[model samples]
Target: MSPDRGDRRAVTAGFGALLSRYRTKTWLGGAVVAGLTVSAAMALRLALSPVAHFYYLPVMPAIMTTALLGRRSSVGLAIVLAIIGCELVVRRDSIADTLANAALFIVVAWAVAEACFRLRAALDAAQTMARDMARRELLLDSILTSTPIITLDCDGRTRRVTQGAAALLGVAPNGALNQPFETLLPGFGAAALQAAQRSDGASRTLWRASRRPNGDAALLTVAAHQLPDDADPEHTVLTLTDQSQAEAARRRERELNDRLSSVWRLNSMGEMAATLAHELNQPLSAAAVYLHTGQADLARIGPVAQPTLRTLDLAKAQLLRAGDIIRRMREMISNGSRAFTEERAAQMIRDLEPVVALIGQDTGVVIRIQTDDEDDHVLADRIQLQQALTNLIRNAVDAVIDRDDGQVTVTGRALGAEGYEISVRDNGPGIAEAQMDHIFHPMISTKTGGMGLGLSVTRSIVESHGSALAVSRPQGGGACFTFRLSRPTESEIP
Candidate 1:
């Protein structure tokens, strides 16, 4: 086929498809309008027969027909109307006048048809836009209704809820439309609502609300979004998400962590038992030798001699040392299961003098004790507090054992209004910067053959008494370990 014929066929096919898309009701309405146009035109012509010259009466009906029935249908009606009007009303005295009158009617009818086609096209576009908008609104409504989140929109001035909000609030759909927001969600307080409304932007809060009367409540995370400043009355949008399950899961996780920590502490105590046994062996062996030598001297020179008295005194000192070692081991084995009491800080330090002296003599390090306030007292487990101080002093002595002027000083001072601070400092190389982070962790050591449980156990003991053990480098060049304990009440103070 030729190109022009093919183009014409395509155009005709498209027009037929467009016309077929319209329903029967549209075609019937178009036909009725066309009939009305023609009848109105004929009646106007007849009514104007007695008038001198009324040529434009039919133009109004022609324009109406064109606008309603479209260009093709209105053009056909205009042709027939022009013929009927010219034959019934115009005079045939002059052929030129009759032709002129017919030409004028045809020109007016064609102009009206063109204007109606343009208006119809505009109307079709408007109808298509309306349908699209309606479909989009339906989709949006479906999405909002099907979502799990509870959504509510409130009027800024009246605080009345809409139907969408009423559904979530468990109230009648239309009944909630004009009611106050507080009435719809009675559990949500007026103060919170007012705060949400007055918020400048989106605000978030955790709200606990009961789903039913006399039932356990759920934790809901609510987010409120304030509308723009230019909006009338200033509306706010609220969205609620349930967080009850998440909170419960987090609580369970914390409980599990605490159990794991307890298990770890038990394992650490088991490892420390072997170290305690080895530590006790030295004092126990010394006590046995002193007792044996004292018995031999009593048998040889009797109790009155100077040698016999010295031997008995030495045996007594060794037995006391052995007893102190046993007490420390018991405290460590109990692992904070002991009861607490009000004890003088100076007395606790004084009790450690024998152990400190033994460690200093063995390691060639001088140990000194200083007290700023003699009356300072703390609420703590006496055995456990002594054990913690003993660990600190031992570690300090070991740290400075290699130096010519090795010194370990234990200081007790009154702190604040109701606290006492005790510190153990050593004039030796400070803790290395790299080892500072894990200094209290199990199995982390700086010295050779060190089990690394001393500081960890010491910290555990201090913490059991409700205080933290802190380590820092002193200005004079050495490591200092300090802890603060709450002072005893005035009545309990010594």
Candidate 2:
């Protein structure tokens, strides 16, 4: 039905547009019609001249038709044709009467021509207005289709539905129309619909959670608007904004922020740790040299005191171990983490639990370890992986140390045939946005008294395995540090 109406308007619009150009065609049409009509009227008069007096009766149709085609200019041409015919046919005895008759014919022809001309003008104007309206309606339909909005009548039936709403409801646009509010949205009530209709544009709204027709859950924010002094009191417009997209976007933002913050924190800690290590390196080296000299001097002295010599040797070994630990911490900045080897994921987690427990033992924090029964075979530097996991667990333990209900969880799970994902979490206040900026800033340390090297070393180990250590805070109040370790494919395995 709409297509047919559109076709008719198109034709009407085309007809007017075709003749509107200011060309010689209109004048040519007027001249040709005047010549032909005058010729025909002359023949009719010649036959009636001997019988009766018909001055202007034969040319009225010509004037009206010409006026319809060429407007005022055509009407003047038709009047000229009438006067020529009168002059050629009038007799000497009937000159005055012929003159009076010719004058009447000109006036009558012009009036008829004027009416016809006005009718054509009005038709073009009306069609132009109709075409404009059609274009506006098309734009309105496009808007309704893309936006998830709908209109409801006072009878609680859908008056209109957008294309987006139709897809969301699992129905065709027309199929969704005229449906009761309850039918379209299960659990929707007439009272709420009426309340929305009574409210003026966005003053009233509701949140609804319901399964769609396709059995998928949807979260919708419903707001309604009714125009003031509307002709139909029940007519209301409703906006159903889907909130799932918003939630997903926020989750993604949090993950990105966590990863960025983790990188920053590692960089800052590494620089400061290097500074501290530098200051301590020379003193520790000098003490080891002194201890070695003391032990040698005792050995050369004839009779050595065994206990004193043993203490000197142990002291030198402790100094060497401390120096090695400092070197590993510097790896975070130097990218020196290497010596990758195949290691059992579960076994590594089991080995690290004792160290984690010792840290939290006196702090009264509950330590929980979750390891996969079927341990994953991951390609990693065993010592480095252990170092990374220990740092995270240690950090998690520190976060919850002050709380009476302090709990820390260490988890390791196989990632299909890939390898394993390991994480450490604690029930403590999470990192804030402002803290993210300073996380990677050199010299900024979370620890108040002095800087630490654990995080810096952990970052190096995780990065060596081709992954980042990311940290995120859950809504329930906790910090989580996560990283993935992969296994070599059969061909890449040693």
Candidate 3:
């Protein structure tokens, strides 16, 4: 059952108990008040006056008691009043007048009691309903306090969590105070925590963690959600839902992303194949000429011609190199590309050479590749980053391809004490002044037949890997697209 429903039941039960207690008190109090007031009036009439004067005592107390006390008590009070009136009549020869007065008191008391009974019953019912409502309110409060959720502020401080949080987090009751949310939900890592804290409105994310509660052995799913802002600003609200179903949803999402990423990579390769084929042709042509010349020389002379042998060896080596380049290009287009991990940054760069080659082939634009750092890695999804870099290089090539002296340079180096910076600089018409702001935005392509998602996808990949990408005009001319990947510390590397 939902916590809310459970609380409602508790409230109803509590209200019923309260109503019963109140009704009992009301009934008893009414009876006592009626009895005391009547007895006092009778005593005063009998003790302080002449014998015949007993009939002069007021009948108001009897009537009032019947009115206030309701049917049963009111009726009983009337009987007592009647007996007193009868005694007075018996003591004197005024029996007719006394009996007449006693009968009048009895009739009045019965009527008042009947009216009081109906009114009192209605009041009692109302009181019970009021009690029930109050009980429900209390139950709602309890449910809110006991729910299994939490909210946090930007300062890494706890703002709210359900009363059941202690059980959810395995902390002592009320011990969650001032605790950093990430301490409990390790999956919220620094970036995710920051995103949640700085979010202006509602956002949802599913997280998976193998961390168990302090005193329990079971793994918990911590569903982290961010509340969005409407017109007014408010503190970010983060709720950690249960781990079971949310984790399953997250797993499915990741799998779907993986499949789509694969399709995208293949599509890119297909698009660049024309250029790659051209790039491969140049090297193959050079090796073929050397082979043909060496064969002619060998036929003119014997099997071993000194100069021809050297030339043949050089041609053989070039062919092998050309074959290696072709293989790399083929691998880049291969359907099965999931063997790489984001944990190896250097390997990621190495794996991107073929895509770069393909771009060179497609555009006939000269690309100078240079790298000064090695044995480095970063936490990044390798395939995604590869796609991003390919897109950027493709853009740079496109930017420079139309120029007579078009040139693109791909460079990677360490940014000293911070991260690794990779840049693709081109020497063609730079981004237009009006289009700079939208350069990395999706569907904002500068080229006549370009899809604008390349740069946008590049930025997404860089950011997802906990990095940043930017655009600027290179010092000499054209545009430069630069992205930084934080250098992995020793522990993060091998």
Candidate 4:
């Protein structure tokens, strides 16, 4: 129940509590009022002694009034009034007549008081019983409304649709009532009904492929039973337990395990990269040395070998680039520390083309690199930035890997005068609405057996450089991941 509703009930129950405490009268208090009433009756009797001497007239009225006000007090008041009548209406001719009349009046008044008392008691008992039943009814209604069950009549018509069952079907309470049970669920047929009838009181699972009015499918653990009815018919009570939450929980657990396994796999790859970097650096250094020796030898051979010398110099430059790549890779694998450099966006895209090709080589998907017309230069940790871009592009490639017309595009461009933006997009099915929130979250993946770490690591890399990674589903039908980087400050600029 809502907090507001509970507060309202509490306020309503306490509203008259204080007044009720002061409204009750004690037995001593009732006797005090009765004493005052009898004194007034005595005064009226004396005043009428000279006029008419009618003792029974005032006594009868006092007896009835006391009976109505207080039952126990009324009996006492009646006995006192009878004594007053005896003293006031004494017969001078016969003592026996006066005594007999007084006794008879006492008996009649006592009986009248008791009859009124018994009638009042009966009314009080009935009212208390009604109040208790009403309270129980309210409690029962609250329970039934929230119960996770849908009751049906013997004729297979929906009689009650609980709030829980309505929520599972994505409808309002009473929305499916008075409808045929078979029509509500896809498989509530004769066979299922017969199984339920055989269950007696035990539960039996019934498959019902039910879709909500809004078209969202639901999985439910359905059970039916034939309630032993005292009437001429038996009711097939259908119980529905929503299995959506349980399914989601299992999915999440699996994702977590996959992510953990992925993390271990990533750690293993880093160790391998570190070892490979050491091994490759030795050969690359020797190759660069050989290229330098060749360029010098060609230089000494004069203008005849000018083309050869130029080619050797080019080879040496590429070798130096390779060495730098190995150094940065080792640094990133050991402890992620940024080594900022002035990097042209166009050059970065050019450097990524070969890697992009290799990624799509086996998958047969087309991957393209696009850059802005302007050669925008930004100060960034080139290796880390490239790693983040690589992760996003790989994710995009995976998204489109299954399609025959799969296409992945990586875009690096200037965001503004002082910033640059990099985006990876794929022409594949976009992320589901349910998984949108947790896509960047660690240990969450949509792909079967996916480690779910690429996006998470990419987001960390982008955030480390003071930017937020964002995602969107474009109208053209694909997922796009993007982030921005700041330009170098005036002091850091070349």
Best-to-worst ranking by TM-score: 4, 2, 1, 3
Clash total of candidate 2: 3
In candidate 2, stretches whose alpha carbon ends up further than 4 angstroms from where it belongs are 1-24, 35-59, 71-73, 83-93, 168-171, 180-234, 239-264, 275-323, 334-494
- Assess candidate 2 and give its lDDT: 0.73
Q: Runs in model 3 with CA error above 4 Å?
A: 1-35, 42-57, 70-74, 89-101, 132-320, 328-397, 403-424, 428-494
Candidate 1 Cα misplacement greater than 4 A, ranges? 1-265, 268-344, 361-366, 376-382, 401-406, 414-420, 428-438, 441-450, 484-494
Instruction: Please state every model's RMSD to the true fold in angstroms.
Output: 18.5, 9.6, 16.6, 9.2
Task: Give RMSD (Å) of candidate 1 vs. truth.
Answer: 18.5
Give the least accurate 10-residue stretch of model 1, judged by summed lDDT.
148-157
TM-score of 1: 0.44
Weakest lDDT window of 10 consecutive positions for candidate 2: 200-209
Higher-scoring candidate on lDDT, 1 or 4: 4
lDDT of candidate 4 over 5-50, digit per residue (tens): 7666455444334323332256665565556556666667778878
Error of 4 at 411 (Å): 6.9
Candidate 1: tens digits of C-alpha lDDT, residues 1-494: 45797666555455544543541235455555556666677677777768755655654675555454544654566566656655666667787877776777667766767776766565556556555656897997776655423324444223434444434444555565545555545456556766766674333675655353335466665556665654435365566555679889999899778658756875776667646766776777777777777677677775567676675665576576556556666655666355668888878788777667878889889899998666576887777788788889889988898899999999999876768889999999999888888789766679899877889889988998889999999899999999998977776444
Best by TM-score: 4
Winner of 1 and 2 under lDDT: 2
- CA lDDT for candidate 4: 0.73
In Å, residue 190's CA in model 1 sits off its true spot by: 59
TM-scores for every candidate against the unseen true structure: 0.44, 0.55, 0.40, 0.57
